[model samples]
Target: MTDVSVERRGHIAVVTVHRPPANYFDFALIHDLADAFEGLDAGDCRAAVLAAEGKHFCAGADFGGGGAPGERVDSSRLLYREAVRLFRVGVPVVAAVHGAAVGGGLGLACAADFRVTVAGARFHANFAALGFHQGFGLSATLPRLVGAQRAAELLYTARKLTGEQAVALGLADRLADGADPLPAAMAFADEIAASAPLTVRSMKQTLRAGLADEVAAATERELSEQARLWATEDCAIGIAANLAREVPVFVGR
Candidate 1:
């Protein structure tokens, strides 16, 4: 089965990520998503709904495969390059986040213009817990969504928030009425499609002017910090503890 698929519904494009269970992403997955968004931007699509077919929207990157920290950082640089391309998509996007959007996964959701989630859905910025700076352009996007103070708190604590709490904090835009978020997200996209397409696109461009450049710059800083931290013993401990489902004990080194 294809890992990524796009279905056209009227003027709304429904883009789906097909990696299962946790839907942990790598460079390939992120590249495919960017390609899909760019395709929609060049086509007749007015808006898009981004949804994943899995128990969780995305659990973040899979770090179980052993690699030296420097090697990992090198691989992540390419992935983050594609991630920034997502912010350059011209049309509006609504994410259907029915389950966990953790770490970089939260960054993916933030790439969308809005999010539709269920009450039990989870949103987490877990980079701090992983002993690295947040990547995927979250340094710019998270603060844009929820403001600087809330973004700082979320990043520092790596606190998990439910869908309702995410909406309360402006992390998520709407709460799904049911367990499934796809219908709600599609409906939201349809609303955008119903608007005058040219006007909507122009307004979106005006509102988001310079955002892609901002995200690009922010990702550069994030990458440098992450690369430095990835080599640290504290980061190693943090990754091990996370994989083992244990709370990490960090020592400043």
Candidate 2:
């Protein structure tokens, strides 16, 4: 089954991430998401909303991607590239975030010009917890939204921020409060769609340029951190502890 589902809503294209049981990212979802965004970027839609069907928009990279275990380190870069393309697309994009937006999922939300999350949405950049590298321009985007101090706290500590906290920290543009976020996001998307597409696109592009430098720097930092962390005993310890439902006993090796 296709993990990513895309459909048109008027001039708005609604994309849903359907990978269940936490909706972990896989190569297929990444590629299919790219296809969907490519189609949307081709001028068929004036706006789009990214929504997930399950409890999460995404967990992160599939641990099984490089093979089940003890395998090569294969990763999916499609989501990253496609997201950059989509972010640079000359149209409005709204992300409707609910449940857990963890690791790359938060990065996905960052790609959108606007976002709405349920009041109870959970925001996290738990890459450090897994000893994995960051993706989806998060290195640049997170700090850009949450400031250096807050971003560091979230990333370095792998703390999960609540939806209200996310909104307060400026990671989200709107919170669903007591209502379903999808409708509010769709309404907001419609509002943006009603505006001149060129103007809307230009504004988004212009606003993001300042963050581009940050994002680029973050890309290198994330890669470096990932490389170092992946080689240490910490990664396996963390993963094993997570899988085993136990607190990691860091040896600081």
Candidate 3:
């Protein structure tokens, strides 16, 4: 079964990440998402909703699996390449983040033009907590969404933000008061789809001018830092502690 699937909801294409449970992504899943987004360009899709089928939007990547740090870095670079394609897509996207969007998952949601989340949803930039440098172009995207100082605070503290907090900080666009955020996001997309498609596309491109280039450059720097940090003793400790559900005691090795 494909991890990513696209369905039509009027003029809005719903691109869903179908990986079960936490929907932790890897290089393959990222490529699938890119493909789904690209495929929509040929259809009647005037807008899109990016959502997931799982308990969380995405819990992040699984680094605890057996792999050399070098291998992990290599895989992450490939994933980021596909992730950049998500930013280049033509249509405006609204993300429905119903559960936790942690680490790179948070970055994925930020890639969308808008996000609709629930009050109980969570957003976190956990790279620092993992002793890992941020990826998924968050170094650029986060600062763009929430400003430099707020992004710095989030990255440095690695704190979790509630959905309401995300909206208050302008990290998320809307908070769904109802149970499911997908319908809210689709409704928002429908509103966008009601507009002239060409105008919407042009406006979206204009608003996001040079953003793809910025994200590409940021990913390069992020990957370079992550390549170095992935091999650190502290990173390993953090990963172990996360899997064990314990507070990580970083010795700053």
Indicate which candidate wins on lDDT.
Answer: 1
Q: What TM-score quantifies how close candidate 1 is to the native fold? A: 0.98
Kindly list the per-residue Cα lDDT of model 1 for residues 1-253, writing each as its tens digit. 3589999988999999999888899999999999999999998999999999889999889888879878888888899899989988899999999889999999999999999999989999999898989988999999999999999999999999999999999999999887899999999998899999889989988998988899999989999999899988889989999999999999975
Summarize candidate 2's per-residue lDDT along 172-243 as a digit string, tens digits.
998886635888899988888888887876777787765645555555565555656666787778777767
For model 2, the stretches where C-alpha displacement exceeds 4 angstroms are 64-73, 76-83, 210-217
Ranking of all predicted structures according to lDDT, beginning with the best and ending with the worst: 1, 3, 2
Where does the lowest 10-residue lDDT sum fall in candidate 3? 60-69
Candidate lDDT values, in order? 0.92, 0.73, 0.91
lDDT of 3: 0.91
Ranking 1 against 2 by TM-score, winner: 1
- Across 1-253, the per-residue lDDT of candidate 3 in tens digits comes to 5799888878889999998778899988989988988889777789999999978999878776759988888888888898899999998999999889999899899999999999999999998888889999999999999999999999999999999999999999999996579989989999999999999999988999989999999999999999999888999888888889898999888
| Residue 153 accuracy (lDDT) in model 1 | 97
What is the lDDT for 149 in model 1? 96
Model 3 TM-score, 2 decimals: 0.98
